[model samples]
Target: MPQITMSAPMSKFSSFNVHDDFVYKNVDGVAIKTAILVPKSLKPGKKAPVLVHMHGGGFMTGNRLFEPWFALWFMQWAESVGAVIVSPDHRLLPESSSEDMADDIVDFWSWVHTDLSAEVSRVTSGATQVDLENIAVGGESAGQYSFRAQLSITNHEIGGFLSVLSALTCPNAKIKAVVCQYGPLDYEVPWFTQPNHQRSIMGAPPAEPGKPEAVIQDYLTRYVDVEKIAVRTESRVEELWPLCVAYAHAGKLAEALGRSDKVMPMRLIEKAESLPPIWFVHGSGDTIVNPDCTMNFVNKVKKLLPQTPMHVSMEPGEHGFDGGVPLDEKWVQDGLSQTAAMSSKPGEQFEVRQTSTTEDYTPDPSKSLPLSPERQALVDDILALYSCQPTIRRVERYTADCVYDDQFVYANDRYKMAGQWFALPKFFKESKNERYEIIKNDRDLIQFKNEQSWTFKLIPKTATINAIVSLSLDPDTVDSDFIQVKYHKDQANDKDYSHNGFGFQFKKFQADNVVKLMSSDEVKYFEKDKHAAKEPVKKYGTGDETGQAPKQDF
Candidate 1:
């Protein structure tokens, strides 16, 4: 067992008190830390539900404390929902393997149940207690793996093959609900096995026996070992049997790596009946993790546990969409509220609710329209100059014209600007400074605002702007290139944006093919009657990403 220590609440914010310190570790003395948010409104004798959230970093890097905006975002959420939020620090790769990280989570969570519950008085001084009956665990990206491992290992402890075969009784690690945001539930899927994804999470690749890159070699060795086990699954190879088999084998590998269970979640589906309700939130435009990953997991879980209460929110934005702007602040609050609400009851199930929101970049180009190639080229040229690049990547071209309506608000003033190519420079000049500086320009969004704040006026003034871009196949007569811009000014002489804020959705367009509802009743019926008669939709990707064998990228 690893040592456990916790610090006192760091801040005296009105709604919650924040605390940070190491929670648990392995025999190797590698300690994992936690940032806890405890609501102040709780009665001294009563207990509060616990939410153990893991941060997103593709399993390679990330921490409990994020950037300024996200930090405030988490704190405000804890304050708003009035729950005990525990964000544990999982060790990153190179220094720790996936197995080791998962072990840390299990150990940390176990310690929370036994040790922390006993010593709750030490941290809270008996003012608050941790409701041991209700515990919700969740994360984003790599963090989601932590939840899977925590649940899997805990499930195994309660009564999986080893426990049942050995006739051992393990204490139940109570979990009330789960919240997963933009995470992959299936690692064996080809999307993750690719060189790029592998490099990001498993480290630079080309793993072989006795390779110089020891980390990559170890990861590959473990992965190969799991693959071999997956091939031996007794059930149909294409079904969930293979996925569960691979995870079971991963549990063996985890032990070899000095841990408890694998960082895979497919096996957990089999135990859905024993698990709590789940909530999933994802961005449709997330390419890094792919929305399909979440969609697939949700679909599988639904098929396995159809009557299980589940909630999903698919919004239009890139990764980390819930943060970064004011409009999204509501989305974050909704997610947090859902988590708190779900955790309120330990045994009851809720109905499944699927909700989604899209920005100006509608898939239906006929409504918003596109610009001609020549016109788009000119817009791209302007953006290239602003981005300080010679030319924009053609592969990153945008086809939809900008949607400039009442979506933009600056210091209480609401104005609509048309023609994104032309509105951009004009909006730049609206700043207190005569000229605006373009900080970042990418295919997804563009960031620009005032530049003279650093010079220091008698009363300093500044602003930061972000514009989410929209692309179409080819623009013919579209006049505007602007989509939606969230502009904020520190001293803009207006009340609406005296602080920082964001906005979107000037005009609503029906979801295009890519982001349309897949699990809807009509779609499912259509698939069952029309599509099921036909062949399965062929999945495709460039190069070896076509779900074939691993492409050796040594």
Candidate 2:
């Protein structure tokens, strides 16, 4: 990514001055750039509320800077609410997974109010004073999930990112309000089955093997290298971008099934007691992200938490309706006034309006199970492989084979001999640093992560893969017994995205100690400072050459 620069305190509009990359904060070993907008009418030394907006791009593309449309919208919002607006350039996928991005957002939130408020005031030379107590967080599309994550599971420590700031640091600190615009709150909803829907919860097309291009199906489960696995796009996403996206949603789905600590806002409808007042805006004609997702979430919140101030407004338009529609200053001012009145008081009035009911919908469970615990577990485990910190370190680093299922059926059965599958594994053993324990069974989750590292071997080289499973499991799967596992890998060279993960199941399972499951040679390999013996690269032949590849039925 190129460095984006802008003049400090430059006037972008008549009502406010914009400052880009005000103070870069290190989040999860990655620096997060933030932009601040201060209203021109605000007097120095007088504290004003702040609105933090998380930009949306399906977690694949987007930034914090204001676009042309956002500029006018921000100008109106600031003038109406009498607040300063801050946007953080949260990290994106392929390089940083959703879990990593969530960590950055949480850290950004904690730092802004807990650490950067004073700096912000001093840097502006007291021109703008931020009222940390009245901070509000909002987002659209993928960005909305970040707010949901923070609200529902912020107190729980999940990954290494928690080392800097635990969600419990300021338990009493609460978000004043939220603005959700056309967000995808439910993954299991039939909203994806609509005629114009571009993507399902699993993700958009080209994710399915052979949908547009013929690919080695198992590769989707094994490794994430786009060089080894080709997508239909010519973009910069060389690493397994699609898998990263699918896995992130999977983790949320698992959390929704009550099988993980990850938070999915729609799943927390019954636990809306702690949520802040919210104003939801959606387009009745929007098909990009089902407007019904937001409605469903709001309706559930209204039913479960009647005291929580809530409002919903729908217009006749498509996704990103605001971008095309010109903003009316009077309407924005009135809306903000109503928001303020409702914030100070509770449930004064609720609003819901729409031009058409054609797009209004509720998901049907007959088409699919509302939630699949097994698939969710697989996704949660994959995410953990990328985000979880090791509880114990037995060595500095090592490359070893940790296999999941040797005879793993590829659902598509692309290969005749299933035992020939393999993936590369590089383990970086680091010392335990912080006391971050958000999930009680996180150790078990980590164990699954280790096993997922093994499943990466099953993928075929230079082939894209996609897998969607419908099997469900008990939410109490955390206590399931472990099974024997083996691993095979080439030498390690600090490669992180080399291992892609897949979902698999063992028919006969039994519990075994970690020490007993790992061979002494493998443990010795971990302790070795020098590179271990180089394993000969395995040769793979096409179906025409060896007649081992499964026939393409589709």
**Over the full model, what C-alpha lDDT does candidate 2 score relative to the true structure?**
0.38
TM-score of each: 0.43, 0.45
* Candidate 2 total steric clashes: 11
lDDT of 1 by residue, 223-261 (tens): 454533211101111222122223222223223223222
lDDT of 2 at 344: 40
TM-score of 2: 0.45
lDDT of each: 0.39, 0.38
Error of 2 at 373 (Å): 62
Candidate 1 segments whose C-alpha is farther than 4 A from its true place = 1-16, 40-43, 67-74, 140-171, 196-261, 325-554
Top-TM-score structure, candidate number: 2
Residue-level error in angstroms, candidate 2, position 139: 2.0
